[model samples]
Target: MKKEWVFGTVIGISLVLGACGAASTSDDYDPNEAGAEDIEPDMAGFVMDQDENRILVVTPMDEETAKEGRAMWVSEAPEGLWIGKQVEVWVDGAIAESFPEQATAERVQELEMSEVEGADLKASEALSTALSEADRENILAVELLAFDQQADQWTVKLKERGDSQGEWKTIVKDEK
Candidate 1:
């Protein structure tokens, strides 16, 4: 009789412990991978321009030209997004393949900016300085490069009026 009682008690304790462990693990969920229904973003890039209704995002290509890079006009952009800020956008439907492609932003997530090693200049400031230096009619893309002790380097791709191709120009901004 005593043996039976001890065995039952041990089984009950084991079940309780298993239940507690499962609950704890479930509570420690990741926000990025919230559930199986979470969809991946269709595109990711830097916010080059924004207005009340839409935002322009430009992805830089490795060919040293902005012509190959993809640019998208994402509507329904969430608040708190600014120029030079990185973001991931989920497109709701088909993307129109214009110079700056158009798509409705189903969901826009502002990506956390990682700390740039040995950098003193802000991304927005870098972009602004590059734009001023380029002095072109239109901007294709602005990319933050490296930072030396004296200045931060940026590659600005610009297009002049009536030009078919954009030009890539390097601009350096002094550290403040």
Candidate 2:
């Protein structure tokens, strides 16, 4: 009886220790690598929104060139995608203002669609009207990294050399 009791006590203690000594969640699992079933059934923004500014195509470079330039950029936030008539950049709302081409949007709609392919029609016209519009201060395709308070404008942080070959980051601190 004494032998049996000692054996059971040892097994119970071992089981408790084993459960207690289990590693923490991160140590035992990868938070970044989770499956659909593991995640909450209704996780908003779980499919993260794509960052449009990640690829800054400075106007004039065009999409093809911008695609090519992504490889050349370092720091990743200071470059621009040069689309034919404009450049695009990532900017916080503070210093940079993005006004939709509401005026020419109708004009773009008026353009004949027969000559344009369905995939390219609307954007092509919108882009064209946006470039030519009277209101177009023509801010496009560049990773604007800073909004300087003193100058009252966004500052471009381009990667001109070595490891710093991309846009570092941008700041638009001026409120509205």
Candidate 3:
């Protein structure tokens, strides 16, 4: 009778431990269901231009060229958006297929600039300088390379139309 009772107690403990282990493993499992936090933006790019109601966004195809990059018009643009600001946009529905495609922005969020601390030159200023240098035509893209706050200079790279190589230009910050 002593032997049977010990064996029965051991079995019960084993069963309890097994059930706990199973429960823990199951609790760690995730179904990966889509939630609000799981939602991703449909498009992300730099703001090329903006109006009261809309903003144009352009994504560069590569580091050197934006000629073939996708362009989209985001309607109902959020306030505080300015030219050359990077943003992520969630579209309300399907995008219209057109040059500078149109879509309604369900949500828009500004992306943090990587290295713009204490910079005097803004992205729009850099773009304007590049455009003027390129004769305001045949300019594929303008990319900000770096900003030197001590020197008050901005290094901007310009990709001209039909050019395989991009040229880097240094722009002194305007005191206006």
TM-score of each predicted structure versus truth = 0.61, 0.21, 0.58
- Each candidate: what lDDT? 0.67, 0.30, 0.66
Per-residue lDDT tens digits of candidate 2, residues 1-176? 99999999999999999999996655455323556124321101000011232322222223354431221111133323322222223222222223211111000001122322222223323333323332212223333233344554433332322233343323322322
> What tens digits encode model 3's per-residue C-alpha lDDT throughout 137-160?
332445545676787777666443
Task: Give the per-residue lDDT digits (tens) of candidate 1, residues 1-176.
Answer: 99999999999999999988883446555445746346678888777777776988777555455344678889987776466667788898899988778999888877776665666666555665665456444645544344455445544444332245645666665466
How many residue pairs clash in all the candidates, one count each? Answer: 0, 28, 0
lDDT of 2: 0.30
* Top-TM-score candidate index: 1
Number of the predicted model whose lDDT against the real structure is largest: 1
Provide C-alpha RMSD values for all models, in order: 8.1, 18.3, 8.1
> Predicted candidate 3: what Cα RMSD to the true structure?
8.1
Model 2 TM-score relative to the real fold = 0.21
Please give the range of 10 consecutive residues that has the lowest summed lDDT in model 2. Answer: 101-110
Off by over 4 Å in 2: 1-4, 7-10, 13-144, 160-176
Cα-based RMSD of candidate 2 = 18.3
What is the model-wide C-alpha lDDT for candidate 1?
A: 0.67
